[model samples]
Target: MELQKGAFYLIEDIDPEKIFTAEDFSDEQRMIESMVADFTQNEIIPNLEEIDHQKEGLSRSLLAKAGELGLLSADVPEEYEGGEMGKISSAIITENISAGGSFSVSFSAHTGIGSLPIVLFGTEEQKKRYLPDLATGRKIAAYALTEPMAGSDALAAKTKAVLTEDGKYYVLNGEKIFITNASFADVFVVYAKIDGEKFTAFIVDRDTPGFSIGPEEKKLGIKGSSTCSLIFEDAKVPVENLLGEIGKGHVIAFNILNIGRYKLGLGSVGLSKSAISYATKYALERQQFGIPIAKFGMIQNKLAQMAAKTYASESLIYRLVGNIEEALHGKVDGREIGAAIEEYAVECSISKVHCSESLAYVTDEAVQIYGGYGYTQEFPAERMYRDARINRIFEGTNEVNRLIIPATLLRLGMKGQLPLLQAAQDLAGQLISLQVKTSSGGEVPLEVEFDMLNRAKKLFLLIGGTAAQKYMKKLAKEQEIIEIMANMCIEIYAMESALLRAKKALAKDAASAETKIELAMAYIYDAFPKLENWAKQAIAYMFESNEEVRTNLSIAKRLSKYQPINIIDIRQKIAKKVLEAGKYVV
Candidate 1:
């Protein structure tokens, strides 16, 4: 197999000119972002109480309103009366609309997992029948994959379907729980097993006979989005409604998740920006002692960290989206697009894990900055705190995604798709020669960080190669070590992305990139130590020999040692910028 051509394996030679960053978004994308931001602030935020209360028809009405603006159609094709815009446009909509909170959940449910199955795996007839209405939000869509017994183990679905005597329909029987958009969804992309063996996907209409929606589940977060179970008792779905091929349901299910994960990460970035703004404004107004609380070092620390992580998350999201778009360029066919998205599954998982965790941190700190007010329902910080918690559990739990990062990388390496073993062998030779170059000594802006990224990758390769050699085929069972290495990989990606984005901005105009440069530096100065510790842990775990472990730890230390930038100055400067701007401007 050829090398996996993505961020994970394609780490050696990335051109800043070619790498996409948020600063590189097209004019049309900026327009779309502004429009969605207006809608979110003007329409959605003001109606939060009503939406959260599950007001009758309010959520659906808002979704229809978005449809009129073509917000619901970004990922659809022109022939189907859809927007036909690129994925970046679609991502912008998802990112900015997140300020709407729960309503964003409803909107994404309708446009993403709910409708993407048909958009990507549906037959031509299926696409024609569903895409037009779905694109316009005339028919809301939902995905039914989580059954009562199969949350993580989705393929072990108890939902059974069998063709009827005439073979025109398949009778289904099962329950799907925790479904988004369930209360108002007009169509559903459901998964069921045939003959208790062959798992398959089906497109079921809301009014299908014997199909019933369960009572709405009272949720902890995203309260405005509908969450209910679906009961399919002898429900008859047309044979033509089947999505993709029988026994290939996992293909559609996982591929849809690849896109979902990245979009979710982008949504996290949007919300983090909002949280920073909310917290910063509150701190400026709230008094402490003789001056505003914003003057406090602790508050400044939180603000700086939030903005830094958000910057990193935003950078990685765009980078990942750019890769998907490049792979998907000119591919109009649904299956082809699905295949393209599946190619970057590892990067998608990284985005999901890193961004979601970043949002969790930002929201938690926002509440901290808000102090007592943050805990109250009167402020958005409390709500944001609640809302951000579900993302880790959503898409796939961070644990599952963490395992996926390494598992997929190693799997590809073993299958010859990624030259992991070969690269590890080369690095091993370097370890013997102690030829690991730690510092670049480059004096240019962010060149230190560029050097830091290279060292981080070398550390990952070092720890990973040792682990693979020690465990061979059984590395998967060492969950602790694998997760530690996964965190290493995640940090490497975050550092590289932030570095690239800031560099791209500097290349355009160095004077204008101070905040971006500081953000990248702040994040790297803060994150590299964590990476170093993880590398140390992996080195310690995989090696029983003290001398070998000592050797690897020394290499890790050399790789980690760099001229530390003014971290205090960096964070304080970032915090002051956000405080002055009242949001994450850079």
Candidate 2:
């Protein structure tokens, strides 16, 4: 299985000369994005209050309307009465529709985890039977994996499925909790242990006997989306309804989860942008101290921080989407597609962690900027704050996703995919020489920032590679070290992504991309200190010997070196632009 080529597989693999930005959206993608925006404003936003009230069937009804516009089938294959639109198309749809508040959860779940399992792992017969209705959203779909006993440890599910003596059906008896879209889904992709041992996936219809949904859960946010428990009281399902291979349900569960994590990140980006727009508008309209609050430095700070992080998150999300779309292109088989997406599992986890946290921060700042009105239900920030909380908790908690990042990194290194060992050895040699090359005059704009990013990548390789060598297999047990690596990776990826996007803009027309350059500079300058601190902490904790610590710290300080810029001023500049536009300026 050859891993598909992409923009970059590792931090060191980033090409300072190469650029990939979201600005290059295709005409079709833009059209789809515009259509989704229109639908979100017309069909979803006005009814947000009613949907959040859980007006019976309101969420599903809006999904049906979206489906009527073929919004739900963007990623489904054309052969299955689906659109077969590219991944970015679907990502844009998800991004635009995310402004609809809680309905975004329902829509994303239905289109992503709900239907994609069948799209990627289902049998031909299964696709023929289910994809049509799911594609059209005539019958909503739900994924049931989390159980009362199993949330993060999904395979620890107590759900049991046994084949009957008639050689026909599997009697499934278990309960799945906190299931999205459970209230009105027509089909469910459920996970259970076969004969109380092998984990397997099954496609069960909502009308299956003994299949019942528990009452809707009262939630902190996204109240408009359906959440309930699914009870399988000896639910009899046909043998052919099984999805993927028996005893291999983890494949489906994890691959679908990878897709879910990144899509959730994209949703976070959209939500953060919405929050910034709301906050900026509020600041402009709500005057304080005989002037608009937008004039205040503190308010400007909050707005700038929100836009900066949103800019970084958006850059990275679309970059990953482009990578996945390229990898999955021309692949017809489900397993092949799954393999393609799994190659970038590390990036997927990074997107999930970084973007979700960005959204959380953005929403918190939005609430802060809105002041008293922000806390009240009268303003959108109140709901934004609530809805954003769940991103950090779900799609694998940020903690869990953080652990996955370093684990996947090590796996890729061991597989010779990332060349970490070689990079570390080379950096160690260079450290002895103390001869790091700095950018010269006549370099491209922001070349110094790019050089600093490259050094940061080397810093990561130095620390992470050394940790891997020292801890060996025991690194898995060192959660703290793993988290440090994850944070370092997150910062590096976000900074580089913004840089690449900004450079792409410069490549197009440097004169008009000043904001893009500012976004990159502000993000990189803000991100460097965090990466430096994380590197120092990891080195301090992992290196017990004093000489080793001193040497590594010296090398780290050298590699992490950068000429400081006034991020506050750049941020103020960014804030002024955001305020002028009344949204995320980037």
Candidate 3:
């Protein structure tokens, strides 16, 4: 469906059956979350200002403390010094600790993208030598993939590894930029060009003769997290240090990035919820117009919008995580895990973009809610605003991510891999063909709307398919853009699925329902118009010519059907729940 510019979608129509609830969280996972949350509040929050001002390495003591609590080992196998929990558990911990600010970046990098290479690509010996120590936080791990010229074109790294005449070791020479955890890293998973044509990864130690770290960088946000350049001057890495076979670095990089995307989304959710909570409480306490600002319709509208965004993010994350977990059951080995992760690259990319964008929107509105105080350092919203900016830029710029999503969807469609969408569409068609009566005894005809939706879906498929075909032929230059379009399509598809799910739920329990159902109805009512607008925009951007002002104006006029709800009020309601829970409960 198409969505209009500046129009808001309601989520009240979402099915409780499909919605992720607290029951989905395992007791052990919940316990871990509690520990991380308490630890962050007790340890990190008080010291955040000191750490940021000092611009020092995170105190080694804190790392050791996290290790002791098993926070550093959630994703590692039980055979090592790890808790052996799955990605969902790791996500929960990451989200909770994000409230700790910059420290969360450091902690997540240490446990996730940093350590994953060893677990996925390392030899048994490598795992034995490093996983235990790394898991226990006795040794810090770093991943070096981005080079001066190879930011998003990760495969074009200039770092070279050459074999010695005796074949005893490979000599490495290269530099890596924006390497997180570089300052105190004990080991690095380095990717380098091999034989001038292939990229390979290696494990390098910090104390190696030719290994050195550049000075720490001053960043826009996440200051407490160390970011620096790594220089490898003729560093000798043993052949055994190779992470995987030659030319296979792409596998390791892509898989780890996929997982990273999910983790990043989880972190965004936490920060967004925190921002909403802070703004809501401030609104209720800060009086304006002779009452709490939240009592005003405008403020309530913002609150509602915030809550709706948060709900969408939360729902998508849990759904994707559950799907990944189900797909990965009994598949614990590296190759199996990598394959599973690669299969969901599209979903991961979409989640990353959606959650990051959602956080950005929520934080912006939050700052607005706080009025003058939100811009001042005296409040957390300002800091959150700064911190939230990076989520869209890093891991892969949202622009690049967008291309990945639509391109991946196109590929999946061509291969008939996305059966769910087809099934959903078929069901929608059946429902549309069969007329149904509303609870008010009114006959509702959805056939026309369904036809429009079907046409929109076809348009998306065609545009996405054409883009993929053109881009893949010139992949070296257009891969990033391809990813952006791919992501956009995936998001469109997901929103459509959510709307469908919401409709089915309402239809099933038209007579007997509770408050959740009411909320679902409100959400669907609000969401449908916006979804339609988005679809129209997507179609216009793809098929409409530059001179097609008539088409553009028509789409714009279609968007005028719904008045803008008071987002401030909606955000306040969301904020109250967030404040009451002290975090994002959903």
lDDT of 1 at 54: 92
Listed in order, each prediction's TM-score against the native is 0.97, 0.97, 0.83
Q: Please, what are the lDDT tens digits per residue for candidate 1 over residues 394-506?
A: 88889999999888888888888788777777875665655343355555766667767877787888888888888978998999989987898888888888888888888
Error of 1 at 486 (Å): 1.0
Q: What is the C-alpha lDDT of each candidate?
A: 0.88, 0.88, 0.70
Better of 2 and 3 by lDDT: 2
The predicted structure with the larger TM-score, 2 or 3, is 2
Error of 2 at 8 (Å): 5.2
**Model 2 over residues 1-586: C-alpha lDDT tens digits?**
2233531444444553443457878788888988998999998899999999999978888888888899999988888889988888999998998999999999999999999999999999999999999999899999999988789889899999999999799999999999999999999999999999999999999999999999999999999999999999999999999999999999999989999999999999999999999999999999987999999999998888888889999998988887888788799787898789888888898999999999999999999998989899999999999999999978788999998888887777788777777777777677666545445564678888877888888888887888899998899999999888888888888888898888878777887688989988888888987777888898889888999889888888888887777788998999999999998876
| Model 3 weakest 10-residue run by lDDT | 3-12
RMSD of each: 2.0, 2.0, 6.1
The segments of candidate 3 whose C-alpha lies over 4 angstroms from its true place after superposition are 1-22, 54-57, 414-459, 462-490, 493-586
